[model samples]
Target: MATLIVEVDDNKLKMVKDVLKAMGVSVDKKSIKPEKAPNETTALAIKDARNGKVTKVESIDVLFKSI
Candidate 1:
């Protein structure tokens, strides 16, 4: 069993998750919040796509064994 950590555009997070799920992989979505609020902070989300068909991802950060 292996874990993959991916940093993707906030808008594409949902699309990524759906792709992973279709491949029978379990995914977890995490939101990155700034420690302090700023005038305008860009929001980012993290998605953990694990198991099955991970080799199909080509454009996202792929971390093996990263929880």
Candidate 2:
């Protein structure tokens, strides 16, 4: 059997699932999560950046000043 991944809005999720079920398609309740990077350090850094847990460097002078 082939696998299908779909991303739907919260409001349309139920409707999409219902349609698929009516077509005899099995729907898994669990949502698919993004795969992490092979390097744990890189994955953590990416997560931190996404969450705004990063320092903003205005200019080279400011960056050097912090060093």
Model 2: residues with Cα > 4 Å off, grouped in runs: 32-67
Q: lDDT (0-100) at residue 33 of candidate 1?
A: 59
Question: What does the lDDT read for residue 4 in candidate 2?
Answer: 42
TM per candidate: 0.50, 0.45
Write down the lDDT of every candidate, Cα atoms only: 0.54, 0.57
Q: Per-residue lDDT for 20 in model 1? A: 78
Per-residue lDDT of model 2, residues 5-65, tens digit only: 3446567678767877887879765443467333665455456656767554554345335
Task: Provide C-alpha RMSD values for all models, in order.
Answer: 9.9, 17.7
Backbone clash pairs for candidate 1 read: none
Model 1 lDDT tens row, 22-60: 878898765455785423212221222333533333455
Give the winner by TM-score.
1
